[model samples]
Target: MKSILKVKNLTMNFGGLRALHNLNISINKKEIAALIGPNGAGKTTFFNCITGIYKPSNGDILISPKGNNEKINGLKPNIITKKGLARTFQNIRLFTSMTALENIMVGCHCVTKAGVIGAILNNKSTKAEERLIIEKSYFILKELGLEIYVNELVTSLPYGAQKRLEIARALATEPFLLLLDEPAAGLNPQETNELDELILKIREQNDISILLIEHDMKLVMSLSDNIHVVDYGKKIGEGTPKEIRNNPAVIKAYLGEEVV
Candidate 1:
């Protein structure tokens, strides 16, 4: 399988501190991969580097979109998104005051070709594009089971629905790779189960590869085709779920807690 994302010797530095060190990881096309580690293990830092939130101090960040490989090291976040990589923050970053549909439309902005003149003149092309955005946004919401909150304010939706809305907004970008940061955080047992189903459905239905940073052991073990364990900014283990479960280093570093 061709890897959609590849990171080689990736490192991040914060002044004198090293946040990540000589890290290497990859996500194959349509594969669901998980990045698991203790808190502050630089999981989110790795995501930021891949998504262009921060430029890595060293190494290459390459992405293969539709088998066309390119280096995205210094590209801006929007440029990376346009290159078929989109992500949701660990924290919910939705526009609370905006309607759910409107929030999703924001993601569509990257793909939309409308200019200031097109918007001001309200031409036929602009109108058509507007309609297309609405249709696509609604479709994403429906797929995520967020159709009921389409017209509601983002802040007014239930917590789980709000989390799904964040994902829906990312989906509106039509990414080949989706990066989720702690997506199951703050959810109840039922909500976590639903989220697990939703994630599997996203992979099956959209045919998009997913790379997530999650601490939920059950969800990670069940949903991930492969797991990469990191500790103190370095990878300790990488393998199938069964191998990861039995790996002593992974157990001593992370899974030793409540993970089984």
Candidate 2:
């Protein structure tokens, strides 16, 4: 299968501080890849670059849907999203006042071509879009086991439920690839398990590729088909979960030297 997303020699710098350095990553079509590292590692920086929140100072980011060799590095976030890339942040970013269903309906706005006037007038120019959006959003809510809370105010839901709602919002965008930053961050064991299952189901049902940056090693190892490790702005290792588990470099980076 073709590569859905590609990053080569990616670097992000803030003044003299380099957050990501010469990072190279590639995710194939319909695959799930994880980025893992120590707390100060450049995983989040790498994510920002890919999602267009940070423009790479040097390197290339390519997406296949728009054809190869197209430079996507410096594109704006919304532009990149329009090109079929979508993401959820490390923190839940919901409209607190909106209901769970409304949060998802907002995501559907990007893919729908209805202009502000069309929406205001409720014109036929957008009726079909609105109908499809409602059906798809409801379907996504059901897929995430969030149907029961669809009408509840987002702020009133549990923390984990709020996070899952964020995922539902991203899926509503109809993205070809999804980037998840620590979706399991604040969840309990049961909630984590549900998130893990839902993530896999997303790949299976939507055929969407995923790039996840997560601190939970168990969750990362279980959900990722491949893993990349970073340390202080640079990639130190990349391999299967088993390989990463046994790598001395990875252990030392995360835990320092173990006294024998």
Candidate 3:
């Protein structure tokens, strides 16, 4: 299988404190990969590094959206999104005042071509682009089963629906590789189960690869084709779910602990 994202010798530093040390991870095309570690394990740091939120102190972040390798470390976050890498945050970040449909339309800004002048003039071309964005945003909402909340204010939605809306916004970016940060963070079991099915459906229908950071072991093991474990910013274990479940190091560090 072709690789979609590669982090080689990745490291991060905050002052003299090292957060990540030579960490390496890879996600293949159409694969569902999980990065699981305890809190303060530097998992979010890795996502920030790869998604251009923070430039890595040392190492490379390469993405192959079209089968051609390109280094993305140090690029702006928006540029990275445009490069077919879109991500949701560990915390739900949505426009509280905006409607669900409008929030998703904001995500389309990266892919849209209308400029300030175009918006001011509302020319034929700009109007057409605006219409297309609305149609596409609605389609994404339907895909995520959020069409019912289309005109509702984001803050009016339930917690689970808000979480799904975040993913919907990311999908509106038209990414080839989707990075989900703690997607199951606050979901109830039923919602998490729904999210599990939603994620698999996303991969199958969108033809995209996924790399997620989640603490939900059941979801991780069930959805992931491969799992990478990190502790103290270093990779301590990596394998299939079965291998990871049996790995001594992982058991000592993560799996052994009470999930909640």
Candidate 4:
């Protein structure tokens, strides 16, 4: 398959209640996909399953490995992330006490192979890695327009910048796939526009595939190459944005228009 993410017959449960039922989805390499749905529609639960926060009781979640097929469903979250998957949270989760650069440095820990002994002893190998890691952190910070904020404590940055920093930290993980959960949550129109542009830039420039969970209809419709609509924990429709916009089932799920 040409799909980077292939979720087949996936199911999730919380005791007796079902969250996702035989969910089948595929995201191709470098494709931007959006998952939009009403509140409590299992969107977050679905994300949880995909990213390894919860293991499915059955089925497989396969991610094309840097270019090979890898079954990633059973792995732990960190392990999955190490295998080139990274995600940002709906809630900002930066370390407020650490400088923005420091937070990013912490994220590079996943890719760091040097043991703590090597890290602490200024071992030659570790020292060389340190230089490389710090350089990468700086490059990512500059790319996200947070170079000036690099030395500043994360808590001191403005809300929008903080959001961007969170994203940068995720990027520093150096993953092929990025899961962005409500990136435009608190942004004003200007910041939202900038974010839209940044996301497009990331896609076009970096060849990054994004799976987004966003409530902002404008952002979702404008940014997505394909769209999935879910309601009451079930997918009512999936199609291109224009197709989704005209889907009566989806429209009635969000905006009640009497079906003819």
Candidate 5:
């Protein structure tokens, strides 16, 4: 079980305030790992650092896409995505004016080889690549059960479907590791359950590792192969779901009570 993502001595600072403190975490190949904590616990900050949205003040963010390790601390976000890491935001960030298919095609840009010249000249290779992008985008829509909304604007889709579309776009990037940020936010119980199933399907079908920051306890407990709990920018617990559910520190800091 090789780790696809590894963070060592991760720390983030905002002036005198420390958002994250010497945090260390990892997600293994094809595993669904959850980062759980109360709000403002630096979970999202950690994600931002790893994704290159904010360069960490101190630490190493390492990613091994296919068993080759590389430090990604200072890489740009798009560069990180091209290195096989893609993420969704806590709030949906779709191109509202774009159709669902087009939104996904936007993510495929990193993998496509068409440069400015190719696009202007409309060469055979560029045309073929454009067709492949369309074809692959359609396949992603179908795979996520979003074919019905393919031609619809993201603004017009239902809330749950909009969430799915965000994930579909991330998938279109062909990520080896997907970082989901509070994906079940604002969903009804039925929608949350649907998301749970969809996440499982993603793991099994795509064989992609997942590292998610979620506060939805049921979804996290049920979906995660391993759970890491953070409190006030420090790791409070890390273990299997069952172990985390019973850990006294996790209960006191975040869980508040026994999970069962």
Candidate 6:
């Protein structure tokens, strides 16, 4: 299987503290991978580094959207998004004042070709692009079962729906690889189950690879084809769910015991 994203010997430092230390991870095309560990284990920091929220102090962030590897470290966040990577936050980051539809439209900015001149002139091309963006955004809402909230303010939606909407907005960016930071956080059992289904649906229907940071053992074990365990900013284990479940280090660090 070909990898869509690869982080090689990645390291991040803040003053005297190192958040990540030579950590490496890879996600294959169409694969669902998980990064699991205790709090402050550097999972979210890894996401931040890859998504351009923070530049890595060392190592390469390589993206192969079409089998051609390109180093993406130090690029702007929007540039990375345009390079076919999109991510959702652990905390929901929606446009509170914008409707669900408008929020998604904001995501379309990276992919849209209409420049400032085109927008100012209101040319045929710009108008056509705007219309297409709206159409595509609405389609994504429906795909994520969010069409009913299309015109509703994001703040007005329930927690689970808002979580799903954050994902929907990421999808609006048309990513080949989606990074989800603790996607199942703050969800009830039913909502987590629904999220499990929704993630699989996104992978199957959109042909996109997924990498997530989640603490929900059930969801991680069921949804991930590969699981990587990290502790104190260092990798401790990497394997299929079964192998991770049985790994002694993983047991000692995150799982606490063998998963039944």
Q: Please report the candidate that would top lDDT against the real structure.
A: 6
C-alpha positional error of residue 113 in candidate 6 after TM-score superposition, expressed in Å: 2.0
Clashes of each: 0, 0, 0, 1, 0, 0
Q: Give the TM-score of candidate 3.
A: 0.97
Give the total clashing residue pairs for model 4. Answer: 1
Candidate 1, residue 120: Cα displacement in angstroms equals 1.2
TM-score of each: 0.97, 0.95, 0.97, 0.95, 0.96, 0.96
Error of 4 at 93 (Å): 1.1
Candidate 4 Cα errors over 4 Å, as ranges:
257-260
Candidate 4 per-residue lDDT over residues 1-260, each given as its tens digit: 26899888888889998888877778888888999888888888888888889988777998885667789897899998888888888889999889999999888989988897996898889999999889999988998899999799999999999999988898888888888988999999999999999998878766789999999999999999989888866779999999999999998998876655
Write model 3 residue lDDT over 44-116, tens digit each, in one string: 9999998899989999989887889999999999999999999999999999999999999999989999999
Q: Given candidate 3, what's the lDDT at residue 223? A: 94
**Model 2 RMSD vs true structure:** 1.4
lDDT of 5 by residue, 61-80 (tens): 99887788899998899999
What RMSD does each model have against the real structure? 1.7, 1.4, 2.0, 1.6, 1.8, 1.8
What is the C-alpha lDDT profile of model 2 across 8-62, one tens digit per residue? Answer: 9998889999998898888888889999999989888888888899888998998
Q: Per-residue error at 158 for model 1, in Å?
A: 1.3
User: Candidate 6 regions off by >4 Å?
Assistant: 255-260
Q: Per-residue lDDT for 1-260 in model 1, tens only?
A: 88989999999999988999999998999999999999999999999999999999999999987777799998999999999998998989999889999999999999999999999999999999999999999999899998988899998898889899999999989899999999999999999999999999999999999999999999999999999999999999999999999998999896465664
Candidate achieving higher TM-score, 1 or 4: 1
Runs of candidate 3 with Cα error greater than 4 angstroms are 255-260
The window of 10 residues in a row where model 4 has the poorest summed lDDT is 251-260
lDDT for 181 in candidate 5 is 95
Lowest lDDT sum, 10 consecutive residues, model 5, at 251-260
Query: Which is the winner by lDDT between candidate 1 and candidate 3?
Result: 3
